[model samples]
Target: MLTIHVVSHTHWDREWYLTFQQFRFRLVELIDQLLALLDADPDYRYFMLDGQAIVLEDYLEVRPERKEDVRRYAQEGRLLIGPWYILPDEFLVSPEATVRNLLIGERVCRRFGPKMRIGYLPDPFGHIGQMPQILRGFDIDAACLWRGVGEAPTELRWRAPDGSEVLLLHLRDSYSNAAWLPADENGFVQGLAELRDSLAPYATTSHVLAMQGTDHTRPRADLPRLLAAADARLEDTRVVHSTLPRYLAAVRDELGERESRLPVISGELRSSQRAHLLPGVLSTRMWIKQRNHACETLLERWAEPFSAIAAHLQPEILNLKPLVDRAWRYLLENHPHDSICGCSVDQVHREMVTRFDWCEQIGEEVTRRSLQAIVQQINATTPAIVVFNPSSSPRTDLVSVEIEPPPEPDQPLLDEAGRIVPYRTLGRRRREFFGMEVDRDGFAFLVAQFGSTGGRVQEQLTFRHAEIAVEEGTAHVHIVVSQREGARPGPFDEALEQAQALLTDESIQHYSVRVVEDEGVTIQFVARDVPPIGYTTYTLRVGATLAVAHAVAHAVAQKPVGATLAVAHDRATLAVAHKPVGATL
Candidate 1:
């Protein structure tokens, strides 16, 4: 006789704002109801809880009582441990986070019963590149997932990118609606019969009938009846209700000593072709970009003050390690798939942007106060000024700085002359750096050297600006660095030559310089900042030498627009237009 396993899952969102008392009450109520139902049949003996819910529910206190009942069921070889918890939106969570959560769940399950070997991720919107390896690393022999498997073959086989073998059972999209109320029971039964008929040709091989749904919110009245009806119809065929672990074991037993490699197939839901289903992927990327930009802005503006303060004061004050950790956790909790599949862009924007804004505000406030304290302390040792740029984009123009003295006069601060000294200019440097010929708009560090007894004290200072001069009619380049005086120019020159060669070969169209003189040539060198989170501004200078013109042409063609041109020939100034001459031109 084929063994039939009944698996029921309890799912709850981890981020709901519920008090401890409310969480306890809900856990107790759900367990009580589920236990009462399970007591009715010896065959009906398994319950799975979402891992996130178990952690958020805080069931530690009542776990002992629940454990006794679970042990009783396990003693009868009935209760099976599932994934430590059902992680919501597996795609959005980092691979490390997913693996850690699985390990945590395994630990939790081991405390209750034997460790679970099967992996279950019912809600990953789509499979990522490295999931199969992660699952196999955790000793999870099989995985049951529903999303991303649109219209693909649903047989068990190895599907990981790294060529690791694992049993994969895809849940049919048709059965997904059956988990909710108001679904047609007759239609569901017919669907099962239809599936059985379709699989008749493959009767020589064993098949798994997988179904996934939430037990927490599902209508209890209709489930038992639906199961009974479906079971009766599927009895004639070799249908068995089995969990992922049991199914995998069966496959292993049948295919012993045989190769299990199979091609990876896209299992995404086809109906999700609409834009709403993928807004989370887009929104999450946008959130990261926006938050990074905002934080970069604040840091650039106050980098001098903050760095000086941090250098002198205790490391405990400027400790951002905890904040970064919290941010990572927040990212895991509010992942896009956790909200809803096929959600509107506007809705995702509202939710993610709001969270990013809040995070930015907190991060900015923390940084601002810490910088203030640092500035206060560093000003005593030497004159110091801090600048804060809170814009999402980089700033190019010179930022003014105000130096101040410490509040305590009795602290006995001395100047270079062995006398009391007031505020003074430390030094100034650009706040940001970019690889290309562009000025990055961000925070800068400036320190003014004080005059000492040895003629004039040369204080060590670091500057962000660098210059590259291409000699007339020669490809050899000269690099002058304002910072890192000891930096070797030979290697940089070689690297620049290599870069130019590659650009010439690949982007040759942008290599020719065109002189356009229309009514008086106006060659404007417009400094364009990088897009969105622009860190640098590039000033394209076009000069009249053949080499310079060639370089300018390449740079201008590569530049967005508004590059400056210098006409060397006596006749009129050189005017260069970005637009190529078409038939109309």
Candidate 2:
């Protein structure tokens, strides 16, 4: 005998095939009818709020008066709210993003009541390799996913790359396991029979589980009455109207039996029986993806920790968490599967651009404030450049800055001890736009480090990008800066062409761009690996050693990380941001 757990649910896509307003019109009707069913029907003891708490947030924005009613049902454990703030496409974002997605969801859900413990994911293109490890962080031990199941069984033990495991259920028939079940005695009985037949073969235990709704499905107006009627008529097994958590609990207890044998599946779920998780999303909307990567790297790797450290240093002046959280929430809201994957309607993506802008703004401001607090204690009078290396390994990289009345074209950039920093960078920027009253052509960029933790650790030697003030705004600053402007190599694609031609004739056994701090441009003959992750800093000095000149030019004219090297025959090499399609470097 099989017990059919008639689990009721709605798979809500906040903004998808239709815009948010269009979806909300139906949501208003659905929730209004749904609460009526739950409130009036004694036997209607269960309803899952689409496995996301954000639905409630959306609904409340329009209908604030129904708060108590929702609180009652959620608190009573009848309406299962979030195990997720929103269902996110696992691979579209970084590991930290996935964690924050779950964290935000849990935070909101717990605000009203206890959240559903199950990691209920009705729809996602694919699951990441590290989900189990992340889910364990939330103490979620069980999950239900559809895509990426492939030949794996409906029930299995799934493990993440980090060896963390979660008991998983793959919805073989998809999330709409029992959608459109007729709200009548005879029809519902037939529906249950067909549902049981479909589920029986795949059922790992005597408990047969089924989801009763699909995307944006309306609440079953007479669900409770029909469920009662079906219960009375069906005799072979108890047909119970239930919530997902209740059904899962029953199934867990049933799994305690000796005959139950769940299979074990491991690693990322990128493929399934019918659906192939779209691999193209990794590169889709590439401009947005690039910005997302930069913002994530800056905020997580630099801004957050640096601010925390700075707060301790100057607690009164640098309390910047409120600004940070606001930005984070905006970013998380856009991480939904359809939104971040860049596969949604034009309207949805348009909204994402605004959110990304907010993220960048907040990141810029927070980074500026945090770094300024630290720089303040360093020096105020002498113009100094602070080169911050975010990577752990040390190598040389170029850093740029803009100052009013910029340096002479050939005059070398200097460090604190007054050394000529050998730089092979050309192309001047005298923009119509200037920051802090600094005029165009006032920008001077130079090489900052030799073999320092490649920009991950703050190496305060030199810098530039965006508008930031180290001291007071618009105040005149004095420092001997290197002004660079000698370029006839054409655009990047063309320059790479010329550099590539120069490289064909060059062959060196071994070469390196060593960091030499001479009072003037000093070049050395040393070589080493760039940091594990980030831009490699390489320096080129005038009157450099013959070995250094040949090595620098040859390396720049390569097909990997963008190289800025001073090579032979007075030829300048320039490669701007060369990342081959999916190259990790």
Q: TM-score for each prediction? A: 0.47, 0.71
lDDT of residue 539 for candidate 2: 26
Worst 10 contiguous positions by lDDT, candidate 2: 509-518
Segments in model 2 whose C-alpha atoms lie over 4 Å from true places: 257-261, 276-284, 379-381, 392-395, 404-420, 424-585
**Overall local distance difference test of candidate 1:** 0.44
Best by TM-score: 2
* Candidate maximizing lDDT: 2
Q: Rate the local accuracy (lDDT) of all candidates.
A: 0.44, 0.65
lDDT of 2 by residue, 1-585 (tens): 678888788888888787777888889888988898888876777888877888888888899999988888889888889878888877777888778778888888876888998888878888877888888999998888788887655678888877888888778778887897776678878898888888778777777776888988876767777777767877677778877677777778878753235676788887756566777877788776777777788778777766776788898777998887777777777877777778778888888888888988998888888877877767534445455555666655445443333432333334444333344333343422112222211221111221132221133322121121223222222221222333111122332233223223333211111111112322221123334332222222233344333443455466336433322334243222213221110
List, residue by residue over 1-585, the lDDT tens digit for candidate 1. 332233455555433344334545677666666666668754454555543434422554665557677656544434455454446455444455566466555655666666556666665556664666777898776766666665544555545667665666665443232344334777766765655555434322355443434624421434556667677766654444445566566656755654254434523232343112454454544555455345434433343234444545766556654554344344333442443222334444345555555555655665666656644554333342333343456543333232221111112212222322112223332222222221111100000111121111122322212233333322221222233343222233333344345334432222111111111111112122322222221111112134434554566678846544446464332334434321000
Candidate 1 residue 228 C-alpha distance from true site, Å: 7.0
- How far out, in Å, is residue 242 in model 1? 3.3
